[model samples]
Target chain A: MKLTFPHLGNAYIAVKALLDELGVDYIIPPFNNKKALEIGIKNSPEFACLPLKINIGNIIQAYREGADTVLITGGCGPCRFGYYCEMEREILQDAGYDIGFITIDAPRGISLKEYFSQLLKITNGINIYKIAKAVKNTTEIAILVDQLEKLTFKMRSIEACRGDTDSVYRDFQQEIRLINGAQSIKKYISQTSQKLTNIRCNTGIKPLKVGIVGEIYTTIDSYTSFNLDARLGNMGVEVDRSVTVSNWVVEHMLKKVFHLPRDLKYAEAAKPYLGAMIGGHAQETIGNSIMYSQKGYDGIVQIYPLTCMPEIVAQSILPAVENDYGIPVLTLIIDEMTGEAGYLTRLEAFVDLLNKRREMAASDR
Target chain B: MRTGGQPIEALRKGMEYLAGQLGNIEIRGAGTTGSGRQLASVIIGADIVKNEITAHAVAAQNLVPEVKTILEIGGQDSKIIILKNGVVYDFAMNTVCAAGTGSFLDRQASRLNIPIEEFGSYALRSDSPVRIAGRCAVFAESDMIHKQQMGHRVDDIVRGLCQALVRNYLNNLAKGKLIAEPILFQGGVAANVGITAAFEEALGKKVIIPEYYDVMGAYGAALIAKRKMEKSIDTNFKGFDACLRDYSARSRECSGCSNVCEVIELFSNDELLASWGDRCGKWSSRLEGRPLVAR
Candidate 1:
């Protein structure tokens, strides 16, 4: 069965690794672009959220390119995103596309047995142990990819040589897409780290630090936020991106199996502002913003989709958080009509404010 | 709204006009907001280009110190900014729907053969306002036409349109929020007496219209520019002369990678001012070493 799934940042890269390693035939849809959005919009409901439409577009495009089986991550949460998979399935079925679907998500009411059964459907009679190995590899890759991204965030700001992180990152991106096998991937990461270490860095100039927290899909997807973290990094700002694909994997996927200690740090931090999860990382956004302020980060930028339900709740609460914390929070609501120029201007201005804030603090000291 | 071969020149003319109007006020550390903020910033050498949300909030704080909420309905978009103690508390702009913005009012006005200036006054003349569906632009239009065909008075129809806009605005952007009093209504649409009346009637509260309502975005931008300059070491205003100067903006598709990102570059006298929109950061870096040549 040919497999296809919508892209959300570098999660697809790990998925690609998993499918390839599992001897599963898969067709990863083309990167999201204007055509994908246009197609998605044409086929979607008038008021459907952006990510859902994009996913539908991706699936339709993939279907046209000869893919039947669809693999989607599911969640039963307060957020609209959790219900997207079922919606997409219904829409696709209405469009006369008979397709097999595999959904992997945290078991809600269903036991691990039902969850594995759904997961194992795509294995196509392959050895379950081998599939498990592939899962481990994918997990490792996801972690590594997240690590590399974090390193880039920290290093890019401090690098004396401009665009050094970008070039290395670009090279690494190309390498990751092409490179097969776990050992080779690890080797490449180590070599890239060594390369990063070798690059000249500013020892004395402390860059302004900012924390990014927002809707998971938009935060993860570069095109959605127009590569916000990288842009901040280029402007010589140390970025602390709270949400990552690996974090999603750990919190959403593996936590059940591992019985991992619940990361209540953000929950505790956001307590004064927000009491509980309003869904779609709203709690995290508040908690992380508080955490960042306490950690002495210069500012926090919250990025989310336009009319995003959960983020809207968070946006309302942010002003109080800002007041209580005495920190600036810039809320950028992403939509298709968002002009890049305005977005960049806002970023530049926010950074300028942060830099001035930092400079003033230093002088006061 | 004037289409031009040179957007930079258009921006220059706009700046020149603003400079002329302001007289001896030293334009220091210019700032831009609204949709085309980046392009305006590039041309004007803006000190800080903030989003319309922050800009409008800042402007409201500057204009009316007691303003708790701001209802700004521009030509294409409407936004609600909630503030507390001169700080942006929470804000939301219209998304995907232009129902409550001036465009809807403008279209309805034109359709009714009434000048937009008189549209609001006509609404005030109506004895009984019809209920027009204000859910979406398309539905509202069809509903208005149906009401008109049913021999509803033009005044009532106009009044209905205003009420529809107010309903749409409240239902969409201002939903679930406590739209506190001392709300300043500013934007292109604030000129409409009909909308103001409808808003007042609907809320049973008075909405204050700022003196320069239509150009409040511009006003907010100026305030931001001034505020930013006050704290900054250098005012990169680029002089008022840049407004009259000739500059050109051009775009070239960079086929360097598979992405084919179209990199746009602004040039003044054939010298590159700024080049961005490159995914690879190849052209934008060329702008790094340049001085503020616009001055």
Candidate 2:
């Protein structure tokens, strides 16, 4: 049976590997795009969150391609994301799309013993060992790819200064695709790091660096910020994104279980601003921005949906952080109407101001 | 201002600065919305903290005055509001979808090796509209590639994609909802000519994209707050410099019941100014000085 799955960062990569191991045919939906949003927007309630729209688009895309079943994750929490499967199912059914949706909820709400049984429903007696191996490989591949991308991005700033970013980035991307086949995460990480180190960068003067912190999806999804990082990079500024799908997963799951401080307890900081579970990671984002600014990032940019409740709470409190930290903060609320020109103009101006500050600082030194 | 500690005093001073910017103009009443609505109300002393839909509708009505249908799409979501005689009659929102939104377009453009700014312009140049199945993004991409192999012009393909988007929007969000003309498309997406053209073609009429579409929501919220200020005895605007304070928030998990709701408490100094997050009003009411009433 041909299977389909929605985009949720590395989830697709992991699922794809699992399907491959099970010897099942599956098609992962393409990265999120306008057509998907259009289809999703058309097929969804007008007030749902951004991720939902993309997922709807993803499922619809899969169905149209003759994928009979779509796999999705289920959650139980104050966050509205937990209810996505039910909501998406209803929307697709209303739009007259026929497909099977299989959801895997966290086994916490149910007996852990039943977890494997639930999996068996879809796997249909597939080898447990193979499934485990596939999952491991997929996770490793995703982590490796992500690590390489981050390193490439880090190298790009210096490469650009050296006037070889374009060529180096192309090579870096190819190397990442190859390293995805690495047998272990350790090997992948090491090779990726070495590749980045090999690239010669002209470290003449330090450029003004900015950190971006916000909702998980919006922060990583280029579509959400109109590819703000590339724009910043083009303007000769290094942009550091504070949120990642892996980081989020680790913080929400592993860190909590281990009581590790690896994840900033942003929920604690955002408690006052958010005051309740409006269901999004806005609090953690604001807290991250504060942390980043404290660490001396020249500027901070917070991007979120126009009416996103969590981000709104963060925005209200960000002004205070910006003031205390003496860091310039720009809050851009994205909705459908954010124009390329308008967005680019703001980026250009922000970068120009940052560049000026860096020059002034250098002169003062 | 002196009643609170350093942070509260700093916030108060900032609020005063904001108040000064308004000069002698009196803010009579105010309204708030979004996740931060309640907190914003508490901070600004707003008279109303309504939902986003209501706040947006109110602002649109005031701005356009004759607006019939309102289309608002943001970074992560999209919404359509139908108004009759300046009052919201019906509304729909697509908060789940990212395909038709600006960010989705941004992603596609970057992937296509095209600057997002030039994406609409490319669509405008298309002569023949390519029939892209804009039902879902993944399908559409493969379909577009197939169309490309079929030798369809890029412009036509782009135009077709735009049309498909408009079709998807109408079919999903606007389904069963009356889409009457004088339809004012306000939001980030209205800025795209290709999408706008697709909308016009789909609706077979002119779609009015308002000025300041990008900031309309914030603008609308601000306008509602401004209106409310007029109706109030005193304006609650915390002022501009309020941003210069060391404001922070804390959380405490309530043990009221099985819910064990995590209640967030806002403090200016050490004094609790506000608290929220109780599912059954266990903490929110208490912090706001209202007695908790059992449901």
Q: Which predicted model would earn the best DockQ?
A: 1
Quantify all predictions' global Cα lDDT against the true fold: 0.80, 0.65
**TM-score for each of the candidates:** 0.77, 0.51
TM-score of chain B of each: 0.87, 0.77
**Local error of candidate 2 at A350, Å?**
1.3
lDDT of 1 by residue, B68-164 (tens): 9899998878888776555555566676578988888888889999998899999999989999999899999999999999999999999998998
- Kindly list the per-residue Cα lDDT of model 2 for residues A157-255, writing each as its tens digit: 665233234344434333432233225434645665786678667679465788887766667766556666655664566778767655654555434
Model 2 residue runs over 4 Å out of place are A9-11, A106-118, A127-132, A161-196, A254-262, A265-278, A361-365, B1-295
lDDT (10s digit) by residue, model 1, range A311-352 = 988988887888788888878888767777646756765775
Per-residue error for B73 in candidate 1, Å, reads 2.8
lDDT of 2 by residue, B1-295 (tens): 1223354454457467756777767556666555455666666666656556655666677778988898876655677877654555445555334556666676666756777677888899987898888777677778888988898877887788788777767775786567887888877777788888878878888888878777676567777566656554566555454445556677888764333557888876676778876543445655545544333
What C-alpha lDDT, on a 0 to 100 scale, does residue A243 get in candidate 1?
A: 83
